[model samples]
Target: MSHIQKLLFIIALLSSSVAFGQLTEDPEDRRDQGKDPFKTQTVDGQPLPFSQRLRFGGGINGFRFGNPFSLGVSPVVGYQATERLIVGIGGTYNYTHYKAPYYTPTTYNQFGVRGFAMYEFIPSILPNLYLHGEVENSSIQVKDDQTSRSNSVGVTAPLVGLTYSQPISRRFGVNLTALYNLNYNDPQGVSQYIYGSPLVIRLSFF
Candidate 1:
C-alpha cells in the first residue's frame, strides 16, 4: 500500500512539472530553437531595418621609417550581407617615397580603389577573427634605376588572409590583419604603397 502511494506521488509531481514548463515556455524561443543564429539578420520573417543592415567603418596604414615609406587612409562602407558576412568598398590614398641607393628619391602619390569581403567563419581560432579577401587597384609612377625608364602603371593586387579583431564597443574595434599578396610576384609586381614585403601586416582602427 505504501509503495502504491509513492508511485502515485511521483506521477503527480512529474505531471505538474510538465504543465509548468508548457505554461512558462516562450513562443519566440520555441520558434528559434534549432535555427541557425548566423543566418541573415532578420526578425519576424522580414529583413532587418536599413539602419541595422548598413554600416560604415575604416582603417589607416602608415609607417615613416623604411626604404619605402607609406601613409594612407582607407574609408569604407559596408553592408551586412549576413550575420557573419560583410561586403564593402573603399578608397585608398597614400603618399609614398622610395629611396634608392644610387638614384635620387622623390615623393610619389599613390591612389587606389579596393573591394573587400570578410567573413567570420571560425570562432575556434580566436574570438572575432575574420577571413579577409581583397582586390585593390593602385596607380603609381615608377622609374627604373637600371634603365632610367619611367612610366605610370596601374597594378591589380589580390590579397588573402586573416584579421583578428578586438572589439572596443558595439561600433568600433582594433583590427590586426596579416595578408599575403598573391600577385606580389606576378609580372605586374607589387605596389609602392604597400609595406616592403609580400607579407603585409596592418594595425588599424575600425
Candidate 2:
C-alpha cells in the first residue's frame, strides 16, 4: 500500500482496537453495541473515515499599491501523526505582478516549504474542526529597478493561522484558513507584509 494508505490502515487498526476494548469493557451495553466501529461523520450517510487529505488552491490579493495580482498553488499532503495532532509537508509558489501610475511595474516571487499542525479541541462535534498553526520558510526575491537600492530580503517569515475543515463527503471537503504574520521582522524594513489571504478557501481530496 502507499504511505497514506498504510497510515489510514494503521489508524483504523488502532481505532478498532479502542472500540473493541470499549465493547469488551461493557458487553451488556445495548446502545453502543450494534453501531459500526468505523462509523463516519456524516448526516446523509456514514462517510468513510479520513485521516489524511490533499488540497490545491490559487487566488489574488490586494497587498500591493496598485491592486497587484498574485497567483499561487500549494499541494498540501497531511497525515494524522496522532489522534489529536497532524503533521504535513507542502510547497508553495507565489508570483505577484505590480503596476501603478507613479511606480514602475515589478514582479515578486516566493517559493518555500510549509509545515502544519493541528489540535482537535472537541471530538463530539461531527466533522471536527481543528485549531491549527503553521510555519513556512520562503525565499523571497523582488525585481524592481525604479525604486531605490537596498539589501535583498532572503529571511524567513513565520506565520500562524486558524484552519477549519469540514468534510462534505467521503472524498471531498472544504478548508478555510486565516493567516497572519507572527514575526514582523522585515529585513528591508519598508513594509509590513502579510503572507497570505485573510480568508482562503481550499477544496480537498482524499
Candidate 3:
C-alpha cells in the first residue's frame, strides 16, 4: 500500500475506536448511577429501581390507656413516590373489651382498610416530620341496642393529619400520627374504632 493510504487507514481506525468508547460507560459510572441519590433516574415522577424504593411496614392501630382496653395493628406497604412523598395501603384489626360501672362487660371487633399518603414538609431540616392524609372504610359489628343501623354496618372515615416517623434500626421503625376523622359525627359515632373521639392519636411500627 502507498504511505498516504496507510496513514489514512490508521487514522480512520483510531477515530472509530474513540467514538465507540464514548458511547459506552465505564465501571465507575455504573457504580455512581446506583448510589447517587439526588441524581437517580426516575420513573413516572418517582425514583428508579422501583423495588428498592419500596418500604413494608405497619402501625399500632390502638392501645389501652383508659376504660375500653384495646389492641390492634395496621399493616402497610408503601412506595417512595418521590424524595418527599410516600403512598401506601394498610389494613386494621382491633379488639376492645369495655367494662363500665353498671353495664355488663362486652367485647367488640373492628376491622377496616385504608389508603394513605404522607409528605415530608422539611426533609432536610426535620426529616421525621410529615403531613399525613387517609381515607378508611370500617366495618363494625355491634349489638342492636347500640346503633340505629340494625347490627353490622360500614362507615367511611376521611381523615387528615400529621405524622412523626422515628427509625429505630435499619429494619425497624415507628410512626406517630394524629388524624381527625371528618365523619366522626356521623350516625355510627357510637361505633368509633378508636374510642369515641374525633381526634385520634396513633403510634405504629414497621
Alpha-carbon lDDT, every model: 0.68, 0.54, 0.71
> Model 3 off-target regions past 4 Å?
1-47, 143-150, 168-172, 191-194
The Cα error of candidate 2 at residue 95, in Å, is: 1.1
lDDT, residue 145, candidate 2: 45
Which tens-of-lDDT digit does each residue in 1-206 have in candidate 3? 99999999999999989765643323234445573233123322323555555678886766775667788788888777766787889998877766666444556677899999989898779876889999988887764333433356688889999999886642235889999878888785644644567777788775
lDDT tens digits, residue span 133-175, model 1: 9998988666554566677777788999998878664335688
Q: Candidate 3: deviation at residue 34, Å?
A: 17
Give the best candidate by TM-score.
3
Question: Estimated TM-score per prediction?
Answer: 0.67, 0.58, 0.69
Ranking by lDDT: 3, 1, 2
Among all windows of 10 consecutive residues in model 2, the one with the lowest summed lDDT is: 36-45
lDDT of 3 at 156: 83
Weakest ten-residue segment in model 3 by summed lDDT: 36-45
Best by lDDT: 3
The model with the greater lDDT, 2 or 3, is 3
- CA lDDT for candidate 1: 0.68
- Alpha-carbon runs more than 4 Å astray in model 2: 1-66, 125-127, 145-152, 169-172, 189-206
